[model samples]
Target: MTLPFFVYGTLRPGEPNHDAFLRGRTRTERPARLTDAVLYDGPGYPYAVPEPGGVVHGDLITALPDAYAELLHALDALEEYVPGDPRSLYERIAREVIREPDETPVRAWVYLAAPSIATALRTGGTRIQTGDWHSRNR
Candidate 1:
Protein backbone atom coordinates (compact mmCIF):
# COMPACT_ATOMS: atom_id res chain seq x y z
CA MET A 1 0.00 0.00 0.00
CA THR A 2 1.11 3.54 -0.62
CA LEU A 3 2.03 5.81 2.27
CA PRO A 4 1.93 9.54 2.71
CA PHE A 5 4.71 11.62 4.26
CA PHE A 6 4.57 15.15 5.62
CA VAL A 7 7.64 17.14 4.65
CA TYR A 8 8.29 20.54 6.20
CA GLY A 9 11.86 21.37 5.45
CA THR A 10 14.45 20.28 2.96
CA LEU A 11 12.27 17.69 1.35
CA ARG A 12 9.61 20.11 0.17
CA PRO A 13 9.38 20.83 -3.53
CA GLY A 14 12.17 23.12 -4.84
CA GLU A 15 14.06 22.65 -1.59
CA PRO A 16 17.62 21.39 -1.61
CA ASN A 17 16.78 17.77 -0.92
CA HIS A 18 13.62 17.48 -2.99
CA ASP A 19 15.36 16.83 -6.27
CA ALA A 20 17.69 14.35 -4.70
CA PHE A 21 15.10 12.46 -2.68
CA LEU A 22 11.50 13.13 -3.70
CA ARG A 23 11.54 14.18 -7.33
CA GLY A 24 9.99 11.57 -9.59
CA ARG A 25 9.44 9.34 -6.57
CA THR A 26 6.21 10.61 -5.17
CA ARG A 27 2.86 9.89 -6.80
CA THR A 28 1.18 13.04 -5.53
CA GLU A 29 2.06 16.06 -3.46
CA ARG A 30 -0.08 18.84 -2.05
CA PRO A 31 0.20 21.61 0.46
CA ALA A 32 -0.69 20.55 3.96
CA ARG A 33 -0.41 21.61 7.56
CA LEU A 34 0.30 19.77 10.77
CA THR A 35 -1.60 21.16 13.66
CA ASP A 36 -0.26 21.37 17.22
CA ALA A 37 3.29 21.52 15.96
CA VAL A 38 5.80 24.34 16.10
CA LEU A 39 8.83 24.72 13.92
CA TYR A 40 12.23 25.92 15.11
CA ASP A 41 15.40 26.76 13.31
CA GLY A 42 18.10 24.09 13.61
CA PRO A 43 21.19 25.44 11.95
CA GLY A 44 20.72 24.60 8.27
CA TYR A 45 17.39 22.91 8.79
CA PRO A 46 14.23 23.15 10.84
CA TYR A 47 12.86 20.94 13.61
CA ALA A 48 9.24 20.39 14.57
CA VAL A 49 7.77 19.82 18.01
CA PRO A 50 4.28 19.53 19.29
CA GLU A 51 2.71 22.66 20.77
CA PRO A 52 -0.82 23.32 21.83
CA GLY A 53 -1.55 26.24 19.52
CA GLY A 54 0.91 25.68 16.75
CA VAL A 55 0.59 24.83 13.10
CA VAL A 56 3.38 23.72 10.79
CA HIS A 57 3.06 24.33 7.08
CA GLY A 58 4.40 21.67 4.77
CA ASP A 59 3.57 19.29 1.97
CA LEU A 60 1.94 15.89 1.98
CA ILE A 61 3.57 13.52 -0.47
CA THR A 62 2.14 10.15 -1.40
CA ALA A 63 4.53 7.49 -2.54
CA LEU A 64 3.99 4.14 -4.21
CA PRO A 65 4.94 1.07 -2.20
CA ASP A 66 8.32 0.58 -3.89
CA ALA A 67 9.16 4.26 -3.81
CA TYR A 68 7.97 4.52 -0.25
CA ALA A 69 10.52 2.00 0.94
CA GLU A 70 13.38 3.75 -0.80
CA LEU A 71 12.14 7.15 0.29
CA LEU A 72 11.91 6.04 3.89
CA HIS A 73 15.45 4.74 3.85
CA ALA A 74 16.80 7.98 2.45
CA LEU A 75 14.69 10.10 4.76
CA ASP A 76 15.68 8.10 7.82
CA ALA A 77 19.32 8.48 6.99
CA LEU A 78 18.95 12.18 6.36
CA GLU A 79 16.98 12.77 9.52
CA GLU A 80 19.29 10.52 11.53
CA TYR A 81 16.41 8.38 12.65
CA VAL A 82 17.33 4.89 13.75
CA PRO A 83 14.64 2.77 15.25
CA GLY A 84 15.31 2.19 18.97
CA ASP A 85 18.49 4.24 18.82
CA PRO A 86 18.92 6.56 21.76
CA ARG A 87 21.11 8.96 19.81
CA SER A 88 18.81 9.42 16.85
CA LEU A 89 18.28 13.04 15.92
CA TYR A 90 14.71 12.64 14.75
CA GLU A 91 11.86 10.24 15.38
CA ARG A 92 9.63 9.12 12.59
CA ILE A 93 6.02 8.89 13.62
CA ALA A 94 2.52 8.88 12.19
CA ARG A 95 0.53 12.05 12.47
CA GLU A 96 -2.47 13.75 10.93
CA VAL A 97 -1.99 16.50 8.37
CA ILE A 98 -4.64 18.86 7.14
CA ARG A 99 -4.55 19.39 3.42
CA GLU A 100 -4.69 22.94 2.15
CA PRO A 101 -7.62 24.64 0.39
CA ASP A 102 -10.18 22.03 1.43
CA GLU A 103 -8.50 21.29 4.76
CA THR A 104 -9.05 17.57 4.47
CA PRO A 105 -7.29 15.55 7.15
CA VAL A 106 -4.98 12.70 6.25
CA ARG A 107 -2.61 10.51 8.20
CA ALA A 108 1.04 10.64 7.23
CA TRP A 109 4.51 9.89 8.45
CA VAL A 110 6.33 12.84 9.99
CA TYR A 111 9.83 13.23 11.34
CA LEU A 112 9.68 15.03 14.63
CA ALA A 113 12.58 16.33 16.62
CA ALA A 114 13.74 14.07 19.45
CA PRO A 115 12.46 15.17 22.85
CA SER A 116 15.82 16.36 24.09
CA ILE A 117 16.49 18.07 20.83
CA ALA A 118 13.13 19.74 20.88
CA THR A 119 13.73 20.94 24.41
CA ALA A 120 17.11 22.33 23.45
CA LEU A 121 15.70 24.13 20.43
CA ARG A 122 12.78 25.46 22.39
CA THR A 123 15.15 26.92 24.90
CA GLY A 124 17.55 28.52 22.44
CA GLY A 125 16.54 28.17 18.81
CA THR A 126 14.60 30.74 16.88
CA ARG A 127 11.00 29.65 16.50
CA ILE A 128 9.53 29.91 13.03
CA GLN A 129 6.26 31.41 14.11
CA THR A 130 4.90 31.32 10.59
CA GLY A 131 5.68 27.63 10.31
CA ASP A 132 6.99 27.99 6.80
CA TRP A 133 10.62 27.01 6.46
CA HIS A 134 11.09 28.52 3.02
CA SER A 135 9.68 31.88 3.94
CA ARG A 136 11.37 31.92 7.30
CA ASN A 137 14.72 30.97 5.86
CA ARG A 138 14.49 33.32 2.93
Candidate 2:
Protein backbone atom coordinates (compact mmCIF):
# COMPACT_ATOMS: atom_id res chain seq x y z
CA MET A 1 0.00 0.00 0.00
CA THR A 2 1.11 3.51 -0.73
CA LEU A 3 1.64 6.02 2.06
CA PRO A 4 1.77 9.76 2.39
CA PHE A 5 4.39 11.75 4.20
CA PHE A 6 4.31 15.28 5.56
CA VAL A 7 7.73 16.79 5.07
CA TYR A 8 8.50 20.04 6.83
CA GLY A 9 12.25 20.33 6.96
CA THR A 10 15.02 19.15 4.64
CA LEU A 11 12.69 16.88 2.71
CA ARG A 12 10.56 19.73 1.39
CA PRO A 13 10.96 20.70 -2.26
CA GLY A 14 14.11 22.60 -3.18
CA GLU A 15 15.67 21.58 0.13
CA PRO A 16 18.99 19.77 -0.02
CA ASN A 17 17.53 16.39 0.88
CA HIS A 18 14.53 16.43 -1.44
CA ASP A 19 16.33 15.63 -4.64
CA ALA A 20 18.37 12.99 -2.95
CA PHE A 21 15.51 11.26 -1.18
CA LEU A 22 12.16 12.00 -2.86
CA ARG A 23 12.57 13.60 -6.26
CA GLY A 24 11.73 10.60 -8.41
CA ARG A 25 10.01 8.53 -5.77
CA THR A 26 6.87 10.50 -5.11
CA ARG A 27 3.64 9.97 -7.01
CA THR A 28 2.28 13.30 -5.82
CA GLU A 29 3.63 16.29 -3.96
CA ARG A 30 1.82 19.38 -2.74
CA PRO A 31 1.79 21.97 -0.03
CA ALA A 32 0.31 20.80 3.24
CA ARG A 33 0.02 21.76 6.89
CA LEU A 34 0.13 19.99 10.23
CA THR A 35 -1.94 21.96 12.67
CA ASP A 36 -1.12 22.48 16.31
CA ALA A 37 2.57 21.82 16.00
CA VAL A 38 5.33 24.16 17.01
CA LEU A 39 8.54 24.33 14.95
CA TYR A 40 11.97 24.87 16.42
CA ASP A 41 15.40 25.36 14.91
CA GLY A 42 17.80 22.47 15.46
CA PRO A 43 20.89 23.98 13.90
CA GLY A 44 20.88 22.58 10.32
CA TYR A 45 17.38 21.15 10.72
CA PRO A 46 14.01 21.84 12.33
CA TYR A 47 12.07 19.90 14.92
CA ALA A 48 8.31 19.86 15.40
CA VAL A 49 6.29 19.33 18.56
CA PRO A 50 2.58 19.22 19.12
CA GLU A 51 1.10 22.46 20.46
CA PRO A 52 -2.42 23.68 21.10
CA GLY A 53 -2.53 26.50 18.56
CA GLY A 54 0.38 25.98 16.25
CA VAL A 55 0.37 25.28 12.52
CA VAL A 56 3.38 23.87 10.67
CA HIS A 57 3.93 24.45 6.96
CA GLY A 58 5.23 21.64 4.80
CA ASP A 59 4.55 19.34 1.83
CA LEU A 60 2.48 16.22 1.56
CA ILE A 61 4.08 13.61 -0.64
CA THR A 62 2.64 10.31 -1.75
CA ALA A 63 5.18 7.63 -2.44
CA LEU A 64 4.57 4.95 -5.03
CA PRO A 65 3.87 1.59 -3.47
CA ASP A 66 6.85 -0.01 -5.10
CA ALA A 67 9.14 2.60 -3.60
CA TYR A 68 7.44 3.15 -0.28
CA ALA A 69 9.56 0.92 1.89
CA GLU A 70 12.82 2.15 0.52
CA LEU A 71 11.69 5.75 0.74
CA LEU A 72 10.50 5.37 4.29
CA HIS A 73 13.69 3.64 5.35
CA ALA A 74 15.80 6.40 3.85
CA LEU A 75 13.71 9.06 5.56
CA ASP A 76 13.93 7.27 8.89
CA ALA A 77 17.68 7.20 8.64
CA LEU A 78 17.79 10.85 7.63
CA GLU A 79 15.69 11.79 10.65
CA GLU A 80 17.80 9.60 12.91
CA TYR A 81 14.78 7.61 14.00
CA VAL A 82 16.05 4.32 15.34
CA PRO A 83 13.08 2.11 16.01
CA GLY A 84 12.62 1.47 19.77
CA ASP A 85 15.63 3.59 20.58
CA PRO A 86 15.00 6.15 23.28
CA ARG A 87 17.92 8.22 22.08
CA SER A 88 16.51 8.66 18.56
CA LEU A 89 16.49 12.26 17.47
CA TYR A 90 12.98 12.02 16.08
CA GLU A 91 10.06 9.68 16.31
CA ARG A 92 8.18 8.69 13.20
CA ILE A 93 4.46 8.80 13.60
CA ALA A 94 1.31 8.93 11.53
CA ARG A 95 -0.70 12.12 11.70
CA GLU A 96 -3.38 13.97 9.80
CA VAL A 97 -2.07 16.65 7.50
CA ILE A 98 -4.27 19.19 5.78
CA ARG A 99 -3.62 19.85 2.14
CA GLU A 100 -3.02 23.51 1.40
CA PRO A 101 -5.45 25.78 -0.55
CA ASP A 102 -8.30 23.31 -0.01
CA GLU A 103 -7.66 22.18 3.56
CA THR A 104 -8.38 18.56 2.82
CA PRO A 105 -7.07 16.25 5.51
CA VAL A 106 -5.04 13.10 4.85
CA ARG A 107 -3.13 10.69 7.03
CA ALA A 108 0.61 11.01 6.59
CA TRP A 109 3.84 10.02 8.26
CA VAL A 110 5.51 12.80 10.24
CA TYR A 111 8.69 13.06 12.24
CA LEU A 112 8.31 14.74 15.60
CA ALA A 113 10.75 15.45 18.36
CA ALA A 114 10.34 13.61 21.64
CA PRO A 115 8.62 15.56 24.41
CA SER A 116 11.79 15.87 26.46
CA ILE A 117 13.71 17.13 23.45
CA ALA A 118 10.95 19.56 22.62
CA THR A 119 10.95 20.85 26.18
CA ALA A 120 14.66 21.42 26.00
CA LEU A 121 14.27 23.20 22.68
CA ARG A 122 11.59 25.40 24.17
CA THR A 123 14.08 26.57 26.73
CA GLY A 124 17.16 26.91 24.55
CA GLY A 125 16.45 26.38 20.82
CA THR A 126 15.26 29.08 18.45
CA ARG A 127 11.57 28.88 17.77
CA ILE A 128 10.37 29.12 14.17
CA GLN A 129 7.19 31.01 14.89
CA THR A 130 6.20 30.91 11.25
CA GLY A 131 6.51 27.12 11.21
CA ASP A 132 8.43 27.41 7.96
CA TRP A 133 11.95 26.09 8.17
CA HIS A 134 13.01 27.56 4.82
CA SER A 135 11.76 31.02 5.63
CA ARG A 136 13.21 31.05 9.12
CA ASN A 137 16.58 29.77 7.97
CA ARG A 138 16.78 32.08 5.00
Candidate 3:
Protein backbone atom coordinates (compact mmCIF):
# COMPACT_ATOMS: atom_id res chain seq x y z
CA MET A 1 0.00 0.00 0.00
CA THR A 2 1.24 3.48 -0.86
CA LEU A 3 -0.62 5.20 1.92
CA PRO A 4 0.68 8.16 3.89
CA PHE A 5 2.60 7.59 7.13
CA PHE A 6 1.57 8.53 10.65
CA VAL A 7 4.77 9.27 12.53
CA TYR A 8 4.70 9.85 16.29
CA GLY A 9 8.23 9.67 17.58
CA THR A 10 11.73 10.04 16.14
CA LEU A 11 10.28 10.20 12.69
CA ARG A 12 8.33 13.37 13.35
CA PRO A 13 9.73 16.65 12.01
CA GLY A 14 12.59 18.22 13.98
CA GLU A 15 13.38 14.88 15.58
CA PRO A 16 16.80 13.33 15.02
CA ASN A 17 15.76 10.95 12.28
CA HIS A 18 13.43 13.29 10.43
CA ASP A 19 16.00 14.94 8.21
CA ALA A 20 17.84 11.74 7.52
CA PHE A 21 14.69 9.81 6.58
CA LEU A 22 11.76 12.04 5.85
CA ARG A 23 12.89 15.52 4.78
CA GLY A 24 12.43 15.89 1.04
CA ARG A 25 10.72 12.55 0.71
CA THR A 26 7.41 13.70 2.00
CA ARG A 27 5.16 16.03 0.08
CA THR A 28 3.18 17.14 3.13
CA GLU A 29 3.20 16.75 6.91
CA ARG A 30 0.44 17.91 9.21
CA PRO A 31 -0.73 17.50 12.76
CA ALA A 32 -2.74 14.36 13.37
CA ARG A 33 -3.66 11.94 16.13
CA LEU A 34 -3.95 8.19 16.32
CA THR A 35 -6.77 6.92 18.41
CA ASP A 36 -6.78 3.71 20.43
CA ALA A 37 -3.07 3.86 21.06
CA VAL A 38 -0.73 5.25 23.74
CA LEU A 39 2.83 6.49 23.56
CA TYR A 40 5.68 5.04 25.60
CA ASP A 41 9.34 5.89 25.93
CA GLY A 42 11.82 3.52 24.32
CA PRO A 43 15.61 3.31 24.70
CA GLY A 44 16.19 6.46 22.67
CA TYR A 45 12.97 6.73 20.74
CA PRO A 46 9.26 6.23 21.44
CA TYR A 47 6.73 3.54 20.75
CA ALA A 48 3.04 3.58 20.15
CA VAL A 49 1.26 0.84 22.06
CA PRO A 50 -2.22 -0.02 21.06
CA GLU A 51 -4.67 0.40 23.91
CA PRO A 52 -8.35 0.94 24.36
CA GLY A 53 -9.42 4.55 24.87
CA GLY A 54 -5.95 5.77 24.13
CA VAL A 55 -4.66 8.40 21.75
CA VAL A 56 -1.31 9.48 20.37
CA HIS A 57 -0.44 12.88 18.99
CA GLY A 58 1.72 13.14 15.91
CA ASP A 59 1.86 14.10 12.26
CA LEU A 60 0.34 12.57 9.15
CA ILE A 61 2.80 12.51 6.30
CA THR A 62 2.08 12.18 2.59
CA ALA A 63 5.06 10.78 0.73
CA LEU A 64 5.89 11.95 -2.75
CA PRO A 65 4.51 9.25 -5.04
CA ASP A 66 7.80 8.53 -6.73
CA ALA A 67 9.50 8.11 -3.38
CA TYR A 68 6.90 5.85 -1.86
CA ALA A 69 8.52 2.48 -2.52
CA GLU A 70 11.99 3.57 -1.50
CA LEU A 71 10.71 5.37 1.57
CA LEU A 72 8.69 2.35 2.62
CA HIS A 73 11.64 0.05 2.40
CA ALA A 74 13.87 2.50 4.23
CA LEU A 75 11.37 2.99 7.03
CA ASP A 76 10.78 -0.72 7.48
CA ALA A 77 14.51 -1.18 7.78
CA LEU A 78 14.85 1.72 10.19
CA GLU A 79 12.16 0.27 12.40
CA GLU A 80 13.71 -3.17 12.10
CA TYR A 81 10.40 -4.49 10.94
CA VAL A 82 10.38 -7.73 9.00
CA PRO A 83 6.92 -8.92 8.26
CA GLY A 84 5.87 -11.62 10.75
CA ASP A 85 9.15 -11.38 12.60
CA PRO A 86 8.53 -11.92 16.29
CA ARG A 87 11.76 -10.25 17.39
CA SER A 88 11.28 -7.04 15.46
CA LEU A 89 11.21 -3.84 17.44
CA TYR A 90 8.15 -2.55 15.66
CA GLU A 91 5.47 -3.58 13.23
CA ARG A 92 4.20 -1.35 10.48
CA ILE A 93 0.44 -1.42 10.29
CA ALA A 94 -2.20 0.57 8.50
CA ARG A 95 -4.48 2.54 10.78
CA GLU A 96 -6.90 5.41 10.61
CA VAL A 97 -5.69 8.70 12.03
CA ILE A 98 -7.63 11.87 12.56
CA ARG A 99 -6.09 14.87 10.84
CA GLU A 100 -5.97 17.97 12.95
CA PRO A 101 -8.31 20.99 12.66
CA ASP A 102 -10.75 19.53 10.18
CA GLU A 103 -10.69 16.11 11.86
CA THR A 104 -10.66 14.23 8.63
CA PRO A 105 -9.86 10.55 8.83
CA VAL A 106 -6.94 9.24 6.86
CA ARG A 107 -5.48 5.79 6.55
CA ALA A 108 -1.74 5.77 7.11
CA TRP A 109 0.99 3.39 7.96
CA VAL A 110 1.79 3.57 11.69
CA TYR A 111 4.77 1.86 13.22
CA LEU A 112 3.51 0.36 16.45
CA ALA A 113 5.28 -1.41 19.26
CA ALA A 114 5.73 -5.08 18.52
CA PRO A 115 4.08 -7.70 20.71
CA SER A 116 7.04 -8.35 22.99
CA ILE A 117 7.73 -4.69 23.48
CA ALA A 118 4.11 -3.96 24.04
CA THR A 119 3.90 -6.62 26.74
CA ALA A 120 6.89 -5.20 28.58
CA LEU A 121 5.63 -1.67 28.26
CA ARG A 122 2.28 -2.64 29.63
CA THR A 123 3.93 -4.20 32.66
CA GLY A 124 5.98 -1.20 33.72
CA GLY A 125 6.70 1.52 31.21
CA THR A 126 6.48 5.27 31.67
CA ARG A 127 3.61 6.49 29.61
CA ILE A 128 3.63 9.93 28.04
CA GLN A 129 0.53 11.35 29.71
CA THR A 130 -0.10 13.97 27.10
CA GLY A 131 0.09 11.42 24.30
CA ASP A 132 2.57 13.66 22.54
CA TRP A 133 6.19 12.60 22.48
CA HIS A 134 7.39 16.16 21.86
CA SER A 135 5.62 17.34 25.00
CA ARG A 136 6.97 14.52 27.14
CA ASN A 137 10.03 16.47 28.25
CA ARG A 138 8.10 19.56 29.11
Model 2 TM-score, all chains together? 0.95
Model 2 local distance difference test score: 0.90
Per-residue lDDT over 25-125 for candidate 2, one digit per residue giving the tens place of the 0 to 100 score: 98999999999898999878899998888999999999988899999889989998998898888998889999988989999899999767888997898
Question: lDDT tens digits, residues 19-60, model 3?
Answer: 999989999999999999999988888999999999999999
Full candidate order by lDDT, most accurate first: 3, 1, 2
- Per-candidate TM-scores read 0.95, 0.95, 0.97
Question: lDDT (0-100) at residue 12 of candidate 1?
Answer: 95
Stretches > 4 Å off in candidate 1:
none
Best by lDDT: 3
lDDT of 3: 0.94
User: Candidate 3: lDDT of 133?
Assistant: 91
lDDT of 1: 0.91
- Candidate 3 stretches with Cα past 4 Å from truth are none
